[model samples]
Target chain A: MRIFTAVVAIAAGILILGGYFFPAFEGMQALLLNWAVILAGAAALVGIFNLVSVHTDKIRRQEKGSVYSALLLISLVATFLFAMILRPNHATMKIVLSGIIIPVEASLMGLLTISLLYAAVRLLRRRADLTSIIFLVTAALLILGSATLPFGNMPVLGTFVGPWITQVLALGGARGILIGVALGTLTTGLRVLFGADRPYGGN
Target chain B: MIELTIILVSAALLFGITLWKRKSPANLREIPALTRLHRTLGLSIEDGTRLHISLGTGSLLDARGGSALAGLAMLRHIAERTSVSDKPSVASAGDPTLGLLTQDTLQAGYQAAGVEELYVPTSGRVTGLSPFGYAAGAMNISQNENVSANIIIGHFGPEAALLTEASDRDNVTMIGASDELSGQSVLFASTQDSLIGEELFATGAYLGAGASHVASLTVQDILRWLVILALLGGAAVKLVGMI
Candidate 1:
């Protein structure tokens, strides 16, 4: 099983690398990435199956938190029926998802950010680490500068310290992180392929 | 042609450096944060404390990244450790594919540890519908599992607090990280050094004894340095333009 998975992984890697060099093979490369998406699509069943099995078992056994499990089962089935079978138009799905999921998420987002901000302020006042201070100051300036538009009249002033600067900094940081991530991804992938790190049936 | 050559050459250089490190006889360095995680894993099981872990919603098939892989590696570790201790390790998922991969992985972990008899599907659930649903499900697990140790490593969004809050209430030792936007909750709560963005990619390679993962870390380090240089150069050019 490990060997088979490794061979498949190697094939996928080669197709990707080959496509980078040979434009003629770009179509195949595109197909490989597409295969990744398809794999993700197919994997969805794994989670659903898990939910069903767990919740159904809980319901059968009448576990303490079985109510939550039962609710999960009902929600999953309802979602599937509403989204897949009904093929509810975008507006209807949007309303349903937003009405239920969005508000809860939004509340969490707001609460988490606000609480963290308060803690950060206290942290800045207390420990005052150089890095933390820098991060805090930059974030504060960004927020303040953007919210107030302090340099409204002077376009140059605004341009120098405004969204553009933030954009450049954000992009640079993002790019650096991306490079690091890409390398990290390649390395781990190779390990799984080589059977050096077998989380699957390979070892 | 040039770009491809550049990428291949850089990749090769990185691969070489990583291989060199593997050949070295240095003992694996223990990260302080990871040590805490290890301690938490052991303690949870020893005391009948449940451990709650999430592999995020995205599966290996759905979203391919180091974060997803790291989440999986951590899950395997949690499962094996928890199983040996005869403690329940509950896992939750937002992405069904990942949920399945998680179950299989946990089952494998238990099998590897010779504790397959302890494997329970109810312990690892796929309950969340969306990102929020996933968080809610995780929160539920934190409460239900009476989680003693909460270790979350994956691609998570702003909804991180839900689970963290539950852990906090339970007074569980929590360690987590997200590859995407680092949640304020995780930042505030977790003692484990959460890897932001690309740092997450190095996790599996760093933890696993493999050539590819090590090489990837080395290359990633080199690339990071290059990026730093570029940023400095870019800043200098911008300063000059301003002048």
Candidate 2:
């Protein structure tokens, strides 16, 4: 069964990749991609069911935070029913997305910024290497340079150092990381294609 | 056409080297995060606390799939090691498809270790579909489940900081990695020992997935040098043109 699954996966991958290189198989590629998306959707439905079942079981067992589990189930069921009845694009959906989801996510982003700042301060405490010192100094400079002054913006510091730090140093580091990620992605894909690594649960 | 050729040639080189070097030992550089993973797992088992592995919000069909798959490979290794313990390592993913894959990896690991009865469906779960939702769910688990160690490697955004913070609050040993650059920055600040850039992909190799994974890492190193050389060559050409 694992071999069969691997074979199917390889065929699908090849077909999709071939379609990109060969125009003749474009339709077939689209069909296969659609099939994959559908399969994913089905898997997501199963996941939803599993989530509900797990929470239900937790509540049944009277586990810690069972009230939270009950609340989660109720919220999920309510949202599902609303979506089914009122349609997803209704005003209620917009309100939920804009008012509830956006605010919650925004608050989380704020928390992340604070967490990052706190971590920056503790970086030296954790590992006081030269690299850590450099990281801390760079972070401090960027923060100080970017901060608003009482009189006016510190153009020399903010305009110069901020852009240099963010545009040059940060961008360079990010690009290097991105290049590494791309190389890793290619190797991983090739590994799967050549049957070197089977992530689909095969031996 | 050039891109395709380069990919094909690189893959061929990788396969060739893998076959040729299969029997030879791989002398890989020391990765502290990976090295500490074994000890962390042992501590988790000894402490009778769960080891949490989070494969972040990455889908199987998207670009993030590679990282998700890599995380699954790591999951297999951790699961096998923890299969004998009363509480095996638990896995969570933001994507349901990846979640299912995580479960399969767990089951496969247990089966391979001849401890099929230790496999539990609830051990691998899809925490949430959205990034923040997933982070929240995973954070709750890390805090409440008495997690001794939290290994997070996959695609994540800034929301990952929340999980890191939660784990930190609980005094859990956190090792993190992410394919996204922004996520990497967050992880760098937050994790105790974080895998940077392509290091996440090396987890399988470092964890003894197989010789193929080791060979793949070697191939990556070779390709990286090639890229560096190409960049230098391009810069030199521009310089010559200016002269």
TM-scores of all candidate predictions against the true structure? 0.79, 0.96
Q: Write the per-residue lDDT of candidate 1 for residues A1-203, one digit (tens) a residue.
A: 76787677667766776886888889999998898777767666765676687778768988678887777678778887888865867677888878977787788777777655555565555345675667677666666565645546345434566576578876676665556656566655555544555555523
DockQ values per model: 0.41, 0.73
In the range A1-203, model 2's lDDT, one tens digit per residue, is 88898898888887887787889989999999899899999999988987887788789999777799899999899889999999999999889889987898789888888998888878878877887788778877887898889977677779898888899989988888899999998888888887766767545
Clashing pairs in 1: A40-B61, A40-B62, A43-B97, A47-B96, A187-B212, B57-B95
Q: After superposition, how far is residue A139 of candidate 2 from its true place, in Å?
A: 1.6
Those runs of model 1 whose alpha carbons end farther than 4 Å from true positions after fitting are A30-39, A78-86, A90-95, A110-175, A193-195, A198-200, B10-23, B27-31, B59-64, B182-193, B205-215, B226-243
Please write out the lDDT profile of model 1 over residues B1-243, one tens digit for every residue: 866655666656755776686786433455545666667766787798787887676556533555667677767766776786645788877776567667778897788788788787667677675877788778877776566777777777666766665666677776766666455234433333444555555445444535555566666667668767977899999989963
- In TM-score terms, candidate 1 sits at 0.79
Q: State the TM-score of candidate 2 restricted to chain B.
A: 0.96
TM-score of chain A of each: 0.69, 0.90
Fnat per candidate, as a fraction, reads 0.53, 0.71
Which candidate comes out best when scored by lDDT? Answer: 2
